[model samples]
Target: MHDALLSALSTVNDPELHRDLVSLGMIERAELLSGVAHVKVNLTTPACPLKGRIEADVRAAVLEVPGVQDVQVTFGATVRQAAQPALPGVKHVVLIGSGKGGVGKSSVAVNLAASLARDGARVGLLDADVYGPSVAHMMGQGAARVTANEQRKMQPIEAHGLRFLSMANLSPAGQALVWRGPMLHSAIQQFIKDAAWGELDYLIVDLPPGTGDVQLSLTQTVQVTGAVIVTTPQDVALIDAARAIDMFRKASVPVLGIVENMSYFVAPDTGHTYDLFGRGGSRKLGEQYPLLGEVPLNVEVRQDADQGIPAVLAHPETAAAQALIQVARNLAGQVSVRALSQSLADLPDQLTVV
Candidate 1:
């Protein structure tokens, strides 16, 4: 009966959450004795909007099993803790960063994380852009605080099958975060060190634009697997992007690849593509560094961003999504290593200043 009850939980899915309660780690414990069932589950948020539905499904699943006389269901909320020992299984920690703002780094990070999650990889995204942490908004999660589990470990908010941590989760809605350098860096460090990111295949950190103190601090502290530079295909953007790459190179963090955002715009009425942001800047920069892929400007991608649904998940068949997925797959292939030894091996033989 216990085994059957557990199996039934595998069938109960969280509709809005879009993950099986079992896979979401919602079912903490289950016991059956003398045809009676006892179960405990953890929820992602306090006042979960789906509490009633989730409870109903749990009861139904356990009762449907044969020889179940009485079923006991328990629910609890997750909280944030100070810290936990690191999980050694996290393979890659990719930083999706850029030198200038408005290059769509967060969009690339969010979509890429979703794409990687779809490919059966355990992915996590840390919104390191303290001033503009848009990952929570992009992922459709309202302002909420993270929780800590029984082991006193910080529990990350789950959305689209990927675990996430961001300053937006901590700040109140509609309020501007006016924090200083030391405080911002400390908060970023806490989000990285304190959160319980278990066995992640890739942990993508969306960094703030330019080579600021936060960027320097992260590269110094965390073992950044590599960094993907996001830039628009324009002369000015390329100049700043090159400076960003130089910063990473000086720090000895290998440039995994470069992704050009808003590379081109395609008109809806006619099958014509316009070079809105100029042409070949990204390609020229790619020639300077390791080029990954370029994502064109698409209405569908913009629409998905507006609705908090990543284009990779909302419209996986689109060309833009495909391009993002390819970049993600490429990033996933990189091996994880510490120190500057293996990472700096791929630096351009001759550094070019833009």
Candidate 2:
């Protein structure tokens, strides 16, 4: 009976990871008592959305065994950490920022990471928005707990083919973060120096709105590759976005490009286009820096974000997703070009023969 129960449980798999629970070390123990089987399952995170589904699958599978009149399923979580060496193998770190709040910076960062992953790049997302961390909920790992490895480094939570770390994952939900400048600086340092982010082709950082201590601390702490400023195609947003560009310039970090989000909206019923926020704002900003791309205002983007899935993955055929993909490609191309230029410049000039 126990063998049958184990086999039955083996058939259940984690929906996201697509691996059987038994092999992943999720099934802790199982026993039969008084015609009722008691089982314990361990999860990767507390905030896993598929908990109910996993529980149902386990219960139903166990009941199929002979002599099992009832089944008792319990769940526990043990979050594991990855190794964090001093020299993390991340090729490029891109910071995504906005001048003001509610400009969809986090959404852009998430979709950019997803798009890069889709293009076969190993990506990592760092939610640097301490005051308003949203990556945990956006990536569907809000209830997930982070654990430390033997080296005592916090492991990034994995989701949507990207490894992510966020303040929301560390603290309790709805808790106010009243941290001062020094505390915020220390936290940012810890996130960069102590977190186990392994090897990644790109590390996308979602900065908190405005040029605050967190942004300053990050620029001072790490050698950022560049920054992408996100803004709506409105006067207020563009004004703030200009400040963001200036902030990156002062920090000596290159402004990779400007992404004009919510550029326009198209009526689904009438198929009519509307410049809801006005147009050509990003193009004007592009005169100072490259314009990565403009993303149209779409309801599906909001729906996907709320559902904890990136639009590119949730609705690949949508215009918003394709626009994001083009941005990713352009960003990747820029990074490559800059790397090559730097490499060439670093080469020692050959001695001229007289």
Candidate 3:
């Protein structure tokens, strides 16, 4: 009966990774308890958006086995760590950037990180924008102070169930950080190296605009998982986005995808939609990258940001919040595909049929 269950489970594949769970080693254990089938499954990431589909498919597959009166399915997740040794206990590091400011890049980063953390992933947010650090304020920790742990490493501030570190917390309010290139580089390096970031599935770095010193220093310091570019539908923003994409390409870092922010707006009273930025700006990228999502303009998002609550958590049913969740899911899917692709490539000469 156990062997039959294995054979049936082999036909069920991960909807996003497009690989059989059994072959991918996602099935931790499978057995028969009298007339019931008990199965344990491990997901690649806690932020997997398709777990429901996977579960339903798994149950359907197990029922095909004879002598199984009922099926009991249980799930757990273990994120795969990269080969990089930069952040000791971090599994993946994702940089959220844009070509210019005022495009809601920070909001996107905050909400995405929050969404992933809500999905049970151990998440950390690092505000790498020294000159204009707003992650602290957006996270409702503007008055919070940074402290050192017993090991003398800077500790991350806990807020809304997410661990975050920011220069805004490290420095005083209304203080201007006039840092030169070398200073900026050193600060970035310390943020990546000197912080006491415990075990985490994803560390999201909200980077400043443009392709400058901080970006260079970060690439030199560690092996990043990839980068997500945020832009509006405006021509100028798209042009700058082109340069940013080229910069990442020159540095040999994969450009995961692009995010279109403020794509459109709908009047709450009249329920009429308006293309506030423009139309089809992402389509101009010429199929070079995936359009992660189009986040609509909503007054509620701004209100939520000020209140230090991410849209995905504060207003999950809103259009803006749903769009942000989609972006997080898409980003997670891409990371899983890349991580599992290497594992698939390194498969042994002989197959191990469980």
Candidate 4:
């Protein structure tokens, strides 16, 4: 019965952690007596957002086990503010961010997650863009809510084999967060520390645009492995991207590389290409730092994001998807720096410190 319970738990995942509850070391205790089974699950935070779903999953898994007649599922949590994986192996934490909105930061994050998942790597995405969480919309989990364990810690929502979290998961659509920096910091802190993010090869955090309080708070709280800057080919956008790089550098966070979005437009009818936002800005930025790749202004990319299926998953063979895949591969290779390094460029004596 013990083995049976463990087997069933293999299918039950801690949504935020993105790993099987059993494998994540979240299943604290499980037993079967006279065909009645009781299980206790643990979480990482006091106000975990995923308690309900955890109980339901535990109940479902135990009931499916043979000799389990009645199932009582309970939850618990670790006292640690941030729960690292039980194992001490290295797991990369990548922050996908931008200095300006409409640059497809979330789209890049989702597509990158899907692309990495396609390559068989364990991946998780966090919609840290508190003021504008769209990972739910992009990943098709917008209506999905996180469940908590008995301790009331949050459980991530799963979709397409990727575990995800977003403010949208906690509240209904169109509801304002009405949260300030400290509140945002606490919420994000719990999201990282209290939620059980398990044995992941890559944990992608989709941050809000600009170098704001949330981004600053994240750098101070979570030991981010790296960062990815998203921008367009426009000069104005590049200027902001530079500022973002400076901020990350100030915080001692490494920048993996830069991704240029809406780089160009290709005419569907005549097979002609247009540099919609002008060209060379990304190349110039890449010259200063490392340039990952440029994503074209493809309609399918936008459509896929709106449809809750990343372009990489929805159209793997398309040019847009192929380009994103290459970017993902490059990003996967960038493990040495934490995103700040790659994006930083030495400024003139006067502007250097700022």
Candidate 5:
């Protein structure tokens, strides 16, 4: 009976991973008693967007086994650590980058980290935009008092369910950072190593606009999981976004996907949706990379962000907030898929565990 149940489940493939559950080691337990089957399906991440569909597939597949009159299914998740050569205490380092400014890259970074933390993962937010750091302000950290532990490691500020750090907080009031190569390099290295980031599942870095030294510095500093490009649905923005994608490719960093921000607007009075920044600009890029989501322009999101509250937490039911949350989940799924693929790459070719 156990063999029969395992055989049935081996035929069930993960929707996103494209492999059987048994082979992937997602079936934590499978038991048979009194002609009823009991099973548990452990997913890659708690924020899996297709969890409902996977659960349904499990039920359908197990029900097909003869003599199993009933089946009970439960779900749990464990985010896979990035294929090593990864950073110490950090499972994934995701960069939220943009081609030019004014596209809300920092906003996406903050919300993405918050969304993941809300889903029960230890998350960190690193503002690597040395020239223009806004994470301290966006997360409502006005007088950020960064302290050092006994080992003299800088401790991250806690905000919005994330361990946050930013150059803005470390610098004095109303002063510009005129530091060049050596100074910039030292700062990034300290942020990556000297900081006391303990066992984070995701470290979302908000990179400054364009493909510049900071981007190169980050790639050289650590093994990055991937990058997510944020752009508006306009020709100018899309052109720069394409350049950003090319830069990641050149750096040997995976381009996770593209997110079209300020994609459209809707009137509160008449319920009319208008394409404020032109339409379908991301379609061309979508051919090469996944279009994670199209986030609408909302005055409330702007107001909430200014007030140091992420939209995903401030207004969960709002369209813009929901879109961002969905984008976050999609990003998590992509990270898990990439990690699993890399791990499989190092294993024997003939994986017959299932």
Candidate 6:
């Protein structure tokens, strides 16, 4: 019965991953008794949007097996962690930040990480937004826990081809974190030093809005490659964006560029564009820095995020997803340029005979 059940389950696949659950190590156990089969499916995160679909698929597959009169599908999650490194092997650490709240900084961070992973780059996202970590929900791991390995190092959870660590995974859902500056600093430090990030091409840090303890802790903890400031095309957002830029400059972290999210909204019925938040605000800010790219205000982006699948992965053909991909490409190019420049700077000078 177990063999038949396992074989049946092999036919069921994760919709997002497009791979058989058995092969993906999602099926934890399958047992049968008195013509009834009980199956346990372990997901990467607890808040998986496709949980119903996955359960239905598994049940349908199991019911097809001979002698399986009843099928009971159970769900659980085991969030994995990486081993701690003496020195992080990440090539570049990009901080996604905003000066004020409600500017969609976390959304950009999640999509940027997804986009980079889609482009075949090894990416990791760290949600340093301790007060309100949204990466877990956005990535569908809201109920996932961060477990430590035998070495006492925290392991990052994996989703959408990216390894991520977030405060949401550490705390229960809707739990408020009340910590002072020193405590906040220690938590951020542990996230950087104790989490096993492995070797990553890019580790995207999603910082909480504003230039606060987390930002200071990150700068003091790790050598950030640069910062990607996110802002809407509005004066209020732009004002805070400037403060964020100044914060990065004061910390000596390069401002890679600025991304103008919610630049405009397009009517689906009439195919008309509306600059709901006003226009050229990011370009105005671009006078002092590079304008990385603009992401349109699209409903699909929000829906995909709620579904725990980033737009870049869920609907790559869409305009919004493509815009994000372009931003990722531009960001990668900037990183490459900086890396090459640093490599040259590290080289010993060769004296020439006069």
lDDT of 6 by residue, 1-354 (tens): 777788888888777555577766678889888988999998644434466889999999999999889998898754222122224577678899999988788988999899878756778999999999889889988888999988899999999999999988888788899899999999998998998888887889999999999999999888787899999999999999999999999999889889999988889999999999997799998988778789999899999889899989999988888888878767765664454443344433332111
How many clashes does the backbone of model 4 have?
Answer: 30
How accurate locally is residue 111 in candidate 4, as Cα lDDT from 0 to 100? 91
Residue range 54-165, candidate 2, lDDT tens digits: 9999998999889999999998754322222113677677899999998899999999999988766778999999999999888989999888988999999999988999
Who is ahead in TM-score, 1 or 4? 4
Q: Provide the clashing-pair count of each candidate structure.
A: 5, 2, 0, 30, 0, 4
Clashes in candidate 1: how many?
5
Q: Native-vs-model 5 lDDT?
A: 0.88
CA RMSD of each candidate after superposition? 14.7, 16.3, 1.8, 15.9, 1.8, 15.4
Lowest summed lDDT over 10 consecutive residues: which window, candidate 3?
345-354
List, residue by residue over 1-354, the lDDT tens digit for candidate 3.
Answer: 767888898899899777788888889889999888999899888878788899999999999888888889999998877656338888888989888888899999999999999888899999998899999998999999989999988899998778999999988899999889999988988888888999988999999999899888888888888999999999999999988899999988888889999999989999999998896797677399888889999999999999988889999999999999988988887777766777786765332465
- Local distance difference test, per candidate? 0.76, 0.83, 0.88, 0.77, 0.88, 0.83
- What is the C-alpha lDDT profile of model 5 across 1-354, one tens digit per residue? 777788888888888888888878888878888988998888998888788888888889889998999999998888899867458888999999999999988888888888888887889999999999888887889578688988999999998778988988898867899988788888999999899998888899999999988899999999999999999999999999999999999999999999999999999899999998897798799999988898999988888889998988999899998999899999999998889996665545333443
TM-score of each: 0.70, 0.73, 0.95, 0.70, 0.95, 0.73
Q: After superposition, how far is residue 13 of candidate 6 from its true place, in Å?
A: 45
Q: Between prediction 1 and prediction 5, which has the larger lDDT?
A: 5
Candidate 1, after superposition: displacement of residue 54 in Å?
43
Model 6 ranges with Cα > 4 A deviation: 1-86, 344-354
Give lDDT for model 4: 0.77
Query: On TM-score, who's better, 4 or 6?
Result: 6
Worst 10-residue lDDT window, candidate 2: 78-87
Q: Please give the ranking of all candidate structures by TM-score, highest first, separated by commas.
A: 5, 3, 2, 6, 4, 1
